[model samples]
Target: MTLEQLRALVSVVDHGGFRAASEALHKSQSAISIAIKNLEEELRVEIFEREGYRPLLTDHGKVLVQKARTVLSQARDLSDLAQHYAQGVEAELRIVVSEVFDIQEVLRALRIIRDQYPSTRLTLFVENFSAPLEILEDKEADIAMVAGGEMFDKIEMTRYEKLCPVSLIPVVSGCSREQKDASELTKEDLHGATQVVVTDRSRNRDERKYGILETSVPWRVNDFLTKKQIILSGLGWGRVPLHMIGDELASGDLVPLSSSDFGPVEIETYISRTTNHPFGPVAEAFWNLIIQRDYEKTNKITVKLQ
Candidate 1:
């Protein structure tokens, strides 16, 4: 019935469960459940199936959620516009970023905006590549930062200057004798080596192409950073972002295996917003700041590396 309730419903659907949605919304699980229940009662429809612990959306629930999204989007636009007009600045901007982009850079950008804009509040959502795109397409986020691959036809995307492709180099800690030196690493080096893999099951489509993951023992991790940690602890060897492990590599804590590139798993960085969607002035200002930050980073990298 209320916009807040509508948002809670959509968040639950977006996150694929109640607990995740609760975490995202910063509300109690019971509060989220109550909001959805109240909305269902007001609409007189069984929006979600109660049979499973993770409630599945009913056919009618899907339709209402779509309608709710539009309604809430409009309501949010109105609020943003009113705040912009009254205070001469924007109220808040919610952005979703993929895991590939350095999280510290994003935080730095926000801090710069706080110093410059002074009125804008920022909310950051971090997820794997696919989830960020979903949030951008659904208009849930004002803007999204992604490490690009083949361009998706779903939304209008602006490619920023390409950041270093997150090279997925095989790495192992000093404790792993088999992976001590980069030159000693070879295709045969992987044979029987316990491999650590970072998987976002929701978005991983390479499983079919990779053919059955061959490992006598393997560790599956959800977070990319965790995968790096496991590798550093000598539990197993796995590919990691080249930029992420620069410090470890410098300190000899971890070493790359094989001089051959991992076929360049280049992750291009991009900033995207929905086509033809309205943005408040604060949103525009924040967008400019993001662009400026990327430009500065590119220039800095070029200078240091070149």
Candidate 2:
């Protein structure tokens, strides 16, 4: 019914009994007991069953505890927000991005952020697929850019906006003609061909592929850069983000592959921030600028990694 009553109930459940709850909450056993009793009275139902040696939450109590935890979490978020505002310009902005975003766009935007907020620190985390979303959920990042497919169907976040579609191209090493030059290649044509694919690094998500043929040999790499290297080595064929392969494709170092199954597929990318945990001033400004940029769709730029 009240925060105090809810906290008391949670403490009792966590610590196993009234005596332990009293010790944890720094309250008398009678006060703890009264708090639980009052909550039951308010709800007009028993919250705990005392038939066993240790009192167990009634089905209702178990359900309410989850709701109580949510309330507590939100309450803490509110307090943190208040503290953030009380402080002046945020000292740092932490950003997590998936591999699909054009690196040039990101670097260009970083330059602008640096000029605008000279005193603020900028931290960038480059991850693949669902890892960006996971970092955001863990409160390790203030903002994230990820593939639209990486987002959960049921997600509650402060904000989300789709950016320009990122292009994906199927390519093979220039030398391996195993199935290259096929204008309309099929799963059967590419069967048993080694396919070097960028794999999801997060253990929480299921493995996914963009252009895998049913019969292609799968060679997994954790990042696009590594995948590009593997493909460039004439070891396998795979679909890679267009931004990452522009130079290779332009130089004929990688041969683009087309199939009856599909052509160049574009993935929708989104910028997301957590709900309730509002971004501080610097992060909000940078986020606004990132989403504002009119980035080139394909062949954006060739970012040479040092």
Candidate 3:
């Protein structure tokens, strides 16, 4: 019933007799006999037939020995896993990510972790802007995916490594800037229209602006998709990730701003550890995956505004 008893049984089967098992296991022969006796008494089965010079296993004894071998193998695996956990492997990891990442890249990382560390639990928190760092600093998250802007300036880069950059292409709804020629468009044209902005979802820190134009009136929203919906409604012009708005641009629901003079903004993304914080093995493995991801290059939003 116990692991010790199960191991004793397997050893006895492998070694041909109680005396041989005792020698193999470096235990007293009396102790081996007593363990086998206890196992038989507990299971109510005569395991060994003490018939001739060499002891032989009964039919039921053979079945139990096979079962005991499997159980003992699993027990050793459990012990190994326990040791692994004690050596900095975590039972769970928390990774907070910004809204603007390639879904495939995230899934690829998750799959690798699932395969490499099956027992480790992973929780993904999707937040926009500074919320990732807010979670990291407050000790809620072990790793954070943050935008590389003034947010990096607030935190020391010694604690972080560069991950990837997400392209934020400034685009307008098809209805806006109809009068301006694409090449001649300038700051004056953009200033004449309302600019949509997505607010940082951080509760702990003051929100910082990335690509907000100073001259235009700002329409602030909480989520990226909502901001996209607003811009699609011709509410305002705003920056969107090139990948997210590809279908919109293809279908003529949206187009890049008619401003050759306007900047092509790219939000530098980073995989940052909380300052002075130690990450578990699972989180570190995840961090490596982010670093190794060969991201497709970010292209500018040059979709002709029609």
Candidate 4:
């Protein structure tokens, strides 16, 4: 079948109806119907059966569609690679990362790429981890750095060494460091303290449930650095990554109100993309740099202020 026919088939399966698929593909509804009919005839099977008013895929059709998705995804990647290749630079690599990663470290890596492969281009998109995964699925990003260990049928992950585990330590400014003890500190101790959380809408439900809340007033901040500043200024006590505030903690600018471990939050790093598409030279080269040396080693700094 032609690539257009395969594309039409995949779109119908994805959008779940010929009319919806037509609208999405910007083709007339009749054209979509004709494509599906042509596909069914070639395959000699009823791809769709009427179920109530909506068309449902036959069992055989479901199997065909599954394969069709991979075919279409790979075809699109081939087209993208070709277009990028024609542009004549080494290649283009697109990546997405979370704010939790040190931005400076990411910039340094790009600088090295520029010095080594002067013709190559690197595009970086920064967002929460979930958004990066979405980009990978849509094929918008060549590679994405996201939270690791979960497997999806369409995405493949290559593990990078674990960066520092984030510990959600509680902090309060102006609270007598002398009285610092986790067990002695209770929710009542946070009664008047303002609690700030980094604006991560997709954070685990357990994080929200276990979070310190002020029955009186709760503050939500969008920027992690700003949130840390607010906490250090003693506006309120909230969870801050231990690594991010090492200098402040050491300098007494920020103090852990309680010594109790809030437990380590595992944030494994990964480079992920669709398994069906092979990485072009640029994507491969950039990923190689990420794996060549441990990110933590290059990015590690004394968080504790002297």
Q: What is the TM-score of each candidate against the true structure?
A: 0.70, 0.71, 0.62, 0.63
lDDT of 3 by residue, 51-147 (tens): 8887789999999998997687566556545755687677777888888876667888889999998988878888887778877765567788887
The residue-by-residue lDDT of candidate 4 on 23-82, one tens digit each, is 999999999989989988998999889765778888998999888887877788788768
By TM-score, is 3 or 4 better? 4
- Model 1 TM-score, all chains together: 0.70
Look at candidate 2 and tell me the lDDT of residue 172: 79
Per-residue lDDT over 1-306 for candidate 2, one digit per residue giving the tens place of the 0 to 100 score: 788898899899989999999999999999999999999999898989999999899998899888888887677688668868887677778899988888788888889888988888878999988888888876778888887555555456647777878888888788766535645666677789888877776855745567677687788878888888888888887888888888988888887777666578788888888876767778887777877774433224423221
lDDT value for model 4: 0.67
lDDT of 2: 0.80
- Which residue ranges in model 1 land beyond 4 Å of their true spot? 1-69, 149-151, 155-164, 201-217, 261-264, 296-306
Off by over 4 Å in 3: 1-88, 152-158, 175-184, 201-208, 295-306
Off by over 4 Å in 2: 1-79, 179-185, 203-208, 295-306
Query: If ranked by lDDT, best first, what sequence of candidates would result?
Result: 2, 3, 1, 4
- Pairs of residues clashing in candidate 3: none
For model 2, state the Cα shift of residue 63 in Å: 8.8
